[model samples]
Target: MKKDIILAGVGGQGILSIAAIIGQAALNQNLHIKQAEVHGMSQRGGDVQSNLRICSEPIHSDLISLGRADAIISLEPMEALRYIPYLSPEGWIVVNSVPYINIPNYPEIERLDAEFAKMPHVISFDVDAIAREHGGVRTVNMVLLGAASLILDIEDTKLEEAIGDIFGRKGDKVVEMNVNAFRAGREAGKKQMKG
Candidate 1:
């Protein structure tokens, strides 16, 4: 099956990190994956999006054509909505239900889910709160990743192991904190799925 996923959010929100972690984890599974990111004005805190295509065969360029995305995982509501046109029919969307937090002078983005809720294929969650409670709010990205895992059909603990392998050597504390964050986010998503 073609697994085309987009991880989107404003800059510095760990959108790419989440994609990288997932990509690494999937590599362990021997999947053929191609990924890229649109780092538009990333340094200025503008929108950043990563596109990942995982399949049994080699993929093409970073871009996935319109209406072909199997799943979209967004770190913010507005970012999720921004990519609505790319989702395939009956596609799954995992969005962080947290309100957008941005610096002044940025465009006053509206809620993405407000529109998504009217769609047939969509799921939203308040992963930011869940991440905040476990590993400080900075870990919201992990929470978003975990939330996105629902549609990807990947085990959360595997993701944790990937995070550990990637970030563990930095320091014991950092690794532990991220592990906690990943677990907390996974649990949050699991709870949402159960509900």
Candidate 2:
């Protein structure tokens, strides 16, 4: 099995954390993994993206060429669109519908929605709101990861275990909150797939 995923979001949206969790889960399953990241002006709310590749066989490169990504897991809608050129024809995009609105010239929501609607394999939703309902805004990344998990070819229990391992240092409460957010996102993803 092989999965090439592009994770996009602004810095501080926990893009790295999502990468970490998925990376850990891949390792837990004895999969080969390669990752590359770009933290453009992250401190200034700039774009942050990561290329994560997982496979049963060995990987030779950290980068994923254009039109080869199996999935794009984004914490922001605009960021999700920004990486469309990198997604494969049959790839899935699991993204949060909320806009970060960091730029003055950000595109209109209607236009963005229309573009997303044209896609055949897209799971777009208000992950921020879901995170809030489960935990808080901090868990937004986990929520997105949860949605993406359905197509990630990794077991959900492994992802949940990785979450626990990552947040274990912070204590049980933090871990529980994140796990709850992940489950909520997973349920939402199921509904999105059905409808």
Model 2: lowest-lDDT 10 consecutive positions = 37-46
Clashing residue pairs in candidate 1, if any?
none
Q: After superposition, how far is residue 113 of candidate 1 from its true place, in Å?
A: 4.0
| TM per prediction | 0.86, 0.96
Worst 10 residues of 1 by lDDT: 105-114
| Whole-model lDDT values for every prediction | 0.77, 0.90
Best by TM-score: 2
Residue-wise lDDT of candidate 2 within 47-96, one digit each (tens)? 88999999999999899999999999998899999999999989999999
Q: Residues 33-103, candidate 1, lDDT per residue (tens digit)?
A: 88987654574677778889988788876789899998888887788878889988878888887756676
